[model samples]
Target: MTEYGPRPVDRRLPTEEARDLMTLVRELADREIRPTAAEEEDAGHFPRATFTLLSESGLLSLPYDEEFGGGGQPYEVYLQVLEELAAARLTIGLGVSVHTLACHALAGFGSKEQRTERLPDMLGGGLLGAYCLSEPSSGSDAASLTTRATRDGDTWTLEGTKAWTTHGGVADFYTVLARTGGSGAHGITAFLVPGDAEGLSAAAPERKMGMKGSPTAQLHFDAVRVPDSRRIGEEGQGFAIALSALDSGRLGIAACAVGVAQAALDEALAYTAERQQFGRPIADFQGLRFMLADMATQIEAGRALYLTAARLRDAGLPFSKEAAMAKLFCTDTAMRVTTDAVQLLGGYGYTLDFPAERYMREAKVLQIVEGTNQIQRMVIARHLAGPEKR
Candidate 1:
């Protein structure tokens, strides 16, 4: 129960309120989302129904202002919802995360009029969004993006490609970054493009080892026209918007990692407690017990790190480096925890009969997305260097 206040102001609240929201989120995740995660993932089915249910429950826009039909919750609370969602279904959780990321560009930079009119559908109900930034030639160096946005009288005609869009085909809108002037980041501009805009087409979804339920594809924009009002901030401000949004997005990914590690720990604990070995339950083994303790401890530590970063951001403090650090720590923790969970279960864990393997696969992607662990390290090191070369 964070006290209501103007945004970016850290507030005091009871832990119980966040706990209550977590309880509600968990119920939906475990009961509704988890059951279908695996099968639909295998079949590459989209979870449009889950998004609708989330919208109905007001979970999709938990961090926005109440005036726009949002839950008016703090980022700290909103991220926990993401954690609970990911623990059950990574794909749906990611879908929610990217949607939030898409909203950030508009929320952080758009005019009051834009927020009042456009934020309702995206921040409330019956809407989905994608953040489009990474291009084929520009990933870590996103400033080098070559997407062209030529102004044709009052309308902007965009021509370029966006790689690794989380909801490439299914999203209702996209927060896209393109080149509006000369080369480099200073030329970049952000736009909110509708899904059905003429000349906007998505490539076939990429074949991936995990997160199949969440569609990932390349978006191609060929002379797509948009109203000038769709511009999200001034031209050349897109890079800043993208980077800031990713700072929060990294925290979202970190929270999901914590949830995943905890889920793997839960599965390992229950399995060991029931399975017998040499006249004693496998849970009685001291070696395995120590492994579980480490996993639990890591998950707890990761949770603390991410929450600390979220609080810092809420306080209007400098938290970009901290966010990267949390993302790096938590995703690595998930990868290790899930792998250990599988080892504890032996052969069963190696197969799809159990959830451990799926968790293991999902963990790998979190490390790569929202900026790779390598990129996170760079961010941290640059912050450490003060204002000199960072």
Candidate 2:
């Protein structure tokens, strides 16, 4: 295994505190994450201890309000931290994004009492979270989900299955959306369910091409009861809350995509400079040099696009269009850049002996998750031209 790790990113952080935070993140990634990533991923071992450490260090709560035990960092700063973590390991980076997404509904829309009692422990108390929305029959058409949450006085009985859940069986809590009224989007409602709630169960983790250490499983809710206090918003507001969370979550995915692309480019750069070909380094060849240059340029463009969206979010602007654009372009860039990286490493890239193959496999999922790139195009077009006709 050739020495391969993330290169130092030249970020334009807003404050000295943020810069110091980045330094700490890099040190932690280099020492704790990068060293064992390949081996652990190969063995399908989840790093629960690393996530616990992150919770203790305040990284898990960076984008929430400090009043609730969060770090109170701007979206810009929080996303850059995500990028750094993703550069080290996709499982860790994507897991953090999912956990943050799970917290969005309660943090943004829960009653004052709910926040006062639950937010503190959730944000920094070593609790992991998962978001439950997509179901066995519904993926892109989320409005058609069949999960039911029927109210019985002060309690609600939830019964449904959630597919492709990131944390699945291992999380401490779940932010779940279920149908509480008639059909379609307006019928949905959000609830915060404890992982150990009676009748809650998870299927085995899916066999995946990459990020094997991150569990992706289906969850079954068989008459799981949740108190009305756990309801995130009004009975019919779940879809809106879900969409709001996704707008920000898409930015997190964009940043992670850029991180993966950056890592791939760094690996290509390292290999090309050292591997001799025709009595000189292959990097000396014009063909490979141009490929490397293109990879770097794409990584920079993706980073800029995601950051621009993050800044818009930080500034309290309507950033849905920008978020969709960033998710679409950055993920596509990751797929392209990682493929080119494999080509640059030639046969060596395809083997498990190097990390380039893993990068390429991991990049494919970013395009599919958090609204497929095709769905993102529809979102951007809707913003530009208004909703489409039936």
Candidate 3:
């Protein structure tokens, strides 16, 4: 219905079901998300209603088990769905990714009883979730987190501050990591904490440049007590669990980046073709044409990279290195393409009158989140060079 874009992407989905899912997502995006994205974002309003609709429509729980209210879709199909959602609005797409990340620890490592008891509500019960791992002093060096969980008889007392939490105050539950032993990665443990727990409070959301609708804030746990049943994985295994979740989460970020890049390129193509200049459209100029061609090519390449990583993940093979590469390349591509898009649109692009500037700003944070592009390089380097010599 929104006739202000280049053309729809021709996706090669694996199954008819996947194709239908794509169509449903596109329809929903066109009708609900794409229309209000700019207005709601400008107002700094979080679309909790839309999020509830997504939950009811089964869009929020695609990559998990069907028996537990998930869609049981493969990563290959799931990431593409994420891409489509992101092309409409990055806030929703990235929020879904973060929600998936918050669910990973329990889905992958929780005991059978825990899964049966809690996974259903989490997957499709309309409960939003947040992942808490990064702290004020520890981001790239996540193992150095100072948030600690002290043990008592049957409960663990959580006392620490978690920074940069994506859903911070709004989330219904939190997947938190804290130091439970000595210093370093081996001393950490994971816990599932309710958002309403007494003494657990969220700071005012950070004033971010873009993605204003998604709250990113620090969470404070002042002697919040969690039962032993909420512990995820072994006591000393939290770091490894966090890293494993990130490997998959990076793919989610990569898909979202590609979606944003594609959206920018579509806007650029549309603007160039219609807006006239001296004699004809500016798209007639060779210089600008080449830029559009390069942007499109980069988007395709980034999509292919993430899909390849998704396939590797679906096969249950080792894909951490490829995931890092895809995240790195796709996010960097988004940043470059979105910036170039703003340039191609000339003066109007810089103004909020067009979505170009918003796309550009949103693309910037993609490179910084999930893992900074610099940290991604370190990961790739370690995979190639086989860990640094101590």
Candidate 4:
């Protein structure tokens, strides 16, 4: 079979600087990420050093404000960078996305003092972060989360468990949500908690089928205390902050999905061109050719959809619906395309000897993370037809 390598995506970056950024990202992915991706992933090793390299290279803070140590790139450029990194290794790409999400509340809503004091380190000072919103009992109905934060003078003590945190044990900081007053979304508040706080601890990482290199775990806050200065936005505004961050985060997931789909398509194309059957390459057959064409088309469409949403976000227009649409379509496309890639590879695709099976396994989680595909549909419908009546 022909040797498989990442095909350089023809990106339509707006500025020369953005183009240069893409080049740097591609070089880094080739040099520091792609080479050991399979091995590290197979060994379930989190590439902390690789993340440090990304931080030093300024890839970790692409979409935030420059004054706060961000790269000041538009979401369009930032997301394309994510796609490239994800094509090389999903763990790195998704980790960056989660870190960005973790910084959202503070970056977007914190006071100037808070941003000046904390944003620089969180953004580019080599600090990894995690978002804490989901709990064991509340996943889809996040408004019903039971985590509580009680205020005593200038200190807030948090108590509860947050489930499915992406960088649970390894993060340097966490953006946490907790109920401050009564039950439901309006009573919730957001806080920025240091990872090494006395009462903060992580449970064992969840054993997952794929993306094993990235830890997903539950965090228990046992009277974890935070100064009032660490509170992000006003009390009872946490749910809104969380939802706002997720709207952008869904776009990140969409980009990662396209990356996975593109990688799978590339693999299938390489394998089909060299694998011969009945005295001709499988790629020469019309059926397989059609399959390849469909895969490529879906990937292109998904890319375009995400870019459209990103452009909308950059222009400061409403993009919640578009973000939902992109997340839904792109992740579903990844699932379908990766499955077809496995089919094209035949028996080899089913084994760990080839990356196709790994791609297939990895694609399955995209449909479930950030928000489930079912939730994406609900979000889309809420925009089109209004919220469902209770």
Best-fitting candidate, measured by lDDT? 2
> TM-score, each model?
0.95, 0.98, 0.98, 0.98
Among all windows of 10 consecutive residues in model 1, the one with the lowest summed lDDT is 1-10
* lDDT score at residue 85, model 4, on the 0-100 scale: 88
- Higher-lDDT candidate of 2 and 3: 2
lDDT of each: 0.87, 0.94, 0.92, 0.92
lDDT of 2 by residue, 1-390 (tens): 343354445456888899889888988888899999989999999999999999999999999999989999999999999998998999999999999999999999999899989999999999999999999999999999999999999999999999999999999999999999999999999999999999999999999999999999999999999999999999999999999999999999999999899889889999999999889999999999999998888888888898899999999999999999999999999999999989999999999999999999999999999999999999999999999999
* Model 4 regions more than 4 Å off: 1-11
> How large an RMSD does model 2 have?
1.2
Candidate 3 or 1, higher TM-score: 3
Candidate 3 — worst ten consecutive residues by lDDT sum?
1-10
Q: Deviation in angstroms for 89 in model 2?
A: 0.4
Alpha carbon deviation, residue 359, candidate 4 (Å): 1.1
Q: Cα miss at 182, model 4 (Å)?
A: 1.2
**Residue lDDT tens for model 4, 1-390:** 222355545456999899899989988988888888888899999999988989999999999999999999999999999988888889998999999999999999999999999999998999999999999999989999999999999999999999999989999999999999888889999999999999999999999989999999999999999999999999999999999999999999999999888888888998999899999999999999999999999999999999999999999999999999999999999999999999999999998877878788888998988889999999999999999999
Task: Residues 200-308, candidate 3: write the lDDT tens digits.
Answer: 9999999999999999999999999999999999998999999999999999999999999988988898899988999899999999999999999999899999999
Per-candidate total of colliding backbone pairs: 0, 0, 0, 0
> What would the per-residue lDDT of candidate 1 be over residues 1-390, giving only the tens digit for each residue?
011111111232336676677768767876788777778887889999889899888888888788877787888888878877887888888788998999988888999999888998998767999999999999989999999999977899999999999999999999999999998889999999999999999999999999888889999999999999999999889999999999999999998898788778888888888889899999899999999999988988898899899889888899999999999999999999999999999998998888889889999999999999999998998888855443
TM-score-superior candidate, 1 or 4: 4
Model 1 TM-score relative to the real fold: 0.95
* Collision pairs in model 1: none
lDDT agreement of model 3 with the native? 0.92
